[model samples]
Target: MIIAVVDGMGGGIGAQIVSSLRDELPTYIDIYALGTNSIATSAMMKSHANKGATGENAIVTSSRKANIIVAPISAVMPNSMMGEVTCKISEAISDSEALKILLPIMPENISLVGLENKPLSLLIKDTIKVIKKEFNIK
Candidate 1:
């Protein structure tokens, strides 16, 4: 399966997701790191993504190939990520058929209704659980 982890700016979140997924999933699963910039992609690549792509076009094109997309909730919000997430990127991610698992990173002014705040590690664990459940792994 192809799991795409998308991030922008410093790529800390993508790096964490890629690292966790790499440690937990079997090697047969492919992890694609999609970043808004080269720095972001490089960070995720260091975490051992099978492949990576950067920039707006790359994000839009590669997103189609992913079976699962892991990213911050800001990825689907245009003009988010301090304006790094362009309209095309937002559109592609939002439009993709992939099962998107977004970290509940409450944006500056927005808030979730009922979702309790959790550390990134816990959220990533939840994401891993879903992946395992999907493939019936253990």
Candidate 2:
């Protein structure tokens, strides 16, 4: 299975997701690091993503093959990530057939209802559960 972890700016979030996925998921699952910039891509690579790409074209192209897309909620919102996420990137992600698992964390300017303010680690653990359930991983 191909899992794409998208992030921008400092790429810290993407790095964390990649690292956790690596630790918690089976090694056979491919992790793709889709970053809005090279810095973000490099950071995620250090976390051991199988492959990495940067910028809008890279994201749009790479997103197609992802069976599941994991990212901050901002990845689907254009002009998000301090304007690092472009309209094309958001459109591609939204249009892809991949099941999306977006973290609720976002800038204070954006608010999502029906989600409690949970610790990031807990949220990440929750995400891991979703993946395990979906893939029926033991």
Compose the digit string of candidate 2's lDDT tens values, residues 1-138: 999999999899999999999999999999999999999999999999999999999999988999999999999999998899999999999999999999998876978889899987888899899999988987
The reply for model 1, stretches above 4 Å from the true place, is none
TM-score of 2: 0.97
RMSD of each predicted structure: 0.8, 0.8
Backbone clash total, candidate 1: 0
Give the distance in Å from residue 39's predicted Cα in candidate 2 to where it truly belongs.
0.8
After aligning candidate 2 to the native by TM-score, how far in Å is the CA of 92 from where it should be?
0.6
Candidate 1 lDDT over 7-41, as tens digits, reads 99989999999999999999999999999999999
* Model 2, C-alpha of 129: deviation from truth (Å): 0.5
Residue 45's lDDT in candidate 2: 99
